[model samples]
Target: MTVILERDCVIAGGGPAGMVLGYLLARSGLRVSVLEKHADFFRDFRGDTVHPSTVTVLRELGLRDRFLQLPVNRLRTLDLVVDDHRLRLVDFSTLPAPETFLVLAPQWDFLNFLGAEGAAFEGFDLRMNTDATGLIIEGDVVRGLRATGPDGDLEIRATLTVAADGRASTLRDAAGLVPEELGVPIDVLWFGLPKPTDPPPPTIAYASPRGMVITIDRGDRYQSGMVVKKGGLDALKQEGLPALRKHISDSATVLATVVEALTDWDQIKLLSVQINRLEKWHRPGFIAIGDAAHAMSPVFGVGVNYAVQDAVALSNAIAGDLAAGTAPEATLAAVQARRMGPVRKMQRVQRFAHGRLARATAGQHLAPRWAIGLLRASLPVTRRFLTRFIGLGFLPEHVDRPVR
Candidate 1:
């Protein structure tokens, strides 16, 4: 039998955006249902950055203390060696107290932490292993969604529906909202390596004419990703895993020994990085946030952070109308309006950053010495900008609405 459930909001995708949105709305005393397609958030190679901006949001909600209880690595610096110039690209240590640095935790651990928090709210409903199939429309208005779960078919009716699914959102497609894609010069290949007894740098990267390789320390393991050209993975794989290992070792000598730990092709995950956004984030009764609204490049490792920030903005924008059981397009547009500026500025910065690296990948040439000189000259000015932009973003949103 098909189960029909009703709530003030039905959110598709229990990702960072959706989960945070669920937690916020439910805390606002509005019944909110979150549909998660995955049985659990155990997928590897996902975004795990918990930036200072997010820390502030959590602190506002009184959840920061609990989140800190979880085992995580707090990285104080972002150091990268490009063209033999060790640039302290970002200094997290420079940020203000109680919010300095970024926390590195598994995406699953963070999601599970949020799930636990949402569970405490009487109005937060999380349907695990449930896939939201399509939107239910009545007279050009998005009323709710139809989903499939372990039982059978499920339909959730609500005053507002949200698409937080991810870069490829079914709900976004169902609503006929298409993203205008920005060109991505590079893709990424993700793999893991055994952490050295003493790591080189917690968050570091090695760049050469070959390409850029980034590594993030996760205690006993180093999660590594290499930037490659568009449609570059298959050819690279055809050359086999040995080529991939050599590629990393050639650029990042610190990872030489451990790069071989990735023995099989199946072990590495490919991320076709893209940056895109919808022309309009909402219709009358439906809205999209996070990656559903904008697909972020992984360059700054801020994808997860930006998504969570979106949740905060969305909750702040529509909490009143949601509680009153009517979310107009203006309220939804306010969320996008609050978020779009940062999103645009960040994407612009990423394009410029990646554009330089993309040239190296394209030509198999070395990192330009002039570019290095330019980077060093700009460091005096760029340091503050990079630290703030990458660590907290431009204007972080705070939760001001009172929750029941």
Candidate 2:
């Protein structure tokens, strides 16, 4: 038998974005349901860096302490290198509140925490192992969603529908929202390295002649990622472990001492990097957040952070509208108006950074040296840049105004 559920908001995809939005909306007393296709988030080598700016928002929600209690590595500084020279850029020590550093934790753990928090709220309902299939629309307005589950197809009617399904969002495609490609091509080679007895400094190492290696401490151990050219993973795989290891050894000083073997290759995971922005982020009563709306390259590692911030912005906007008894259409417009500028700015910044790093030969040759100099040259500027990436810059008067 098929089930029919009704709610105020139906959020498709139970990632960090959906979960956080669910928590916030539910806390505001709105009936919210989150439908996630995956039963669990135990994926490997996913995004794990949570910046302090996000931590500040978590603190506002009273989840900061709980977040800190989770298994995580606190990184206070970012290390950049080209050739033999190394520079510490964007040291978290200079930033205020929740610590200026980034917290390293398994992405699953963070999402799990959000899910748990959402579940505890009286107005929140999360449906796992359920997939949203299509929109329930009437006259160009999204009124609900159709989903598939164990029993069969289910219909969920809500005032609003939110798509947070990730880079390849089914809902976004079904709704026919086209994403604009930013044209920056970069990929990542991700893997886990055994914990060293004497740990090296927490750092993001850019190897000259092309390649980026980020070493993140995961409490008892460390995880690392090397950035490679787009569609470059196949070539690396063909060249095999010796060549890959040699590449890492030659470019990165921190990774030089890390022993490599063919067995280690088995444990590494790879992902292609892309930056995408939707032509429009909102419809009549349907909207998108996170990667569905804007997928940034992984250069800055702000993907999750920005997604969480988006959730916060949307939740706050919706809450304000609901409080004023605004219509669903009006609320959606308000949300878009509040979010579009920041989202656009974020996309532009990501594009710039990705472009600087996307150069095949020249970038690979000059990146490390340039990065070292850039970081070493200006401490204040680096701190401000990191702050901006984390969503802590001046807002326009319109975005700053409280929803009325």
Candidate 3:
């Protein structure tokens, strides 16, 4: 027997976007159901960055202090090694005091924290192990969604449906809303290496003629990612794991000794990079946000933050309308309007970074030495721009109405 349910809003994907949206809308006194396909939030190599923009949202929600209580690494600056010159690219310290640095926590821990907080609201329903398989559309209007839950098939009819299901969104596909692929030239291979007893300075990335490697400090282990040309992982594997190890070691000498920990090919995980966005974000009773709406690159680790921002913008835009049982297509389009500018700007930045990375992965320097020297000379100006650009992002959204 199919179980029928109804809510003010039904959100697919309990990621940063859906979870935050659910929390926000529920707190706004709107009945919200969030569907998570997974029983638990334990996905590894996911975006773990809780940027300053997100911190402000947390502050608005009165969860900032509690969020800080979690085990997290505070990154003060983003240091990048371009060839032989190590550049302090972005300095979060320059931002406003107290909540200046970027927070790096396990994505699962963040999601769990959010889920727990959202549970406090009477209207928030987070359904675990529930896969939102298809949209319930009736005559060009998305009525709700059909899901396969722990028991059996479930039907959730809602006033407004949100597809936050991620880049490969089932709902987005079902709605026939395709994202325009903004070509990305590089993909990343994620793996962990044992941290040395006397670790190197917390350098975030290293780029040279060899390739680009990201090094994240995770207490005992270095959560690392090696950037490769898009669709080049198979060739990299054909070259053997030893070649992979050597390439990593050569790019970032700090990992030379630790690269031995990667003895097997299975240790590496490939993240196929993509930058894409939907031209039209809404139909009649539905809208898409987060990765479902626009997939971002991992350039500045803004994926999580941007998704959260989307939720903030979305909730602020339509929480009232949703609570009143009518979030018209115009209001949904307005949410997209409020967010589309930032998304487009950031995607441009990501695409530019992708071009540079693509060239670097092909044994080319990121930029001319003169350009690097010029940037170094203009540190004061560049650092401030980067701090705001990466930390707060463009047109950062805030929670508008008081939570019920």
Work out the TM-score per prediction.
0.96, 0.90, 0.98
- lDDT string for model 1 (27-137, tens) is 889999999998999999999889998988888888888998898888888887876578888887788888987899898999999999999999999999999999999
lDDT of 3 by residue, 32-98 (tens): 9999999999989999989998988898888988999998888888888888688887888888876
Best by TM-score: 3
TM-score of 2: 0.90
Candidate 3 runs further than 4 Å off = 402-404
The lDDT for every candidate, in the order shown, is: 0.87, 0.74, 0.91
User: What TM-score, to 2 decimals, does candidate 3 have?
Assistant: 0.98
| Per-residue lDDT of 6 in model 2 | 74
Candidate 1 ranges beyond 4 A from true positions: 363-367, 377-380, 401-404
Pick the lDDT winner.
3
lDDT of 2 by residue, 236-262 (tens): 889988888877666555555664632
Range of the 10 consecutive residues with the lowest summed lDDT in candidate 3: 395-404
Residue pairs in collision within model 2: 82-368, 209-364, 210-364
Report the Cα lDDT for residue 78, model 3. Answer: 80
Model 1: lDDT of residue 173:
98
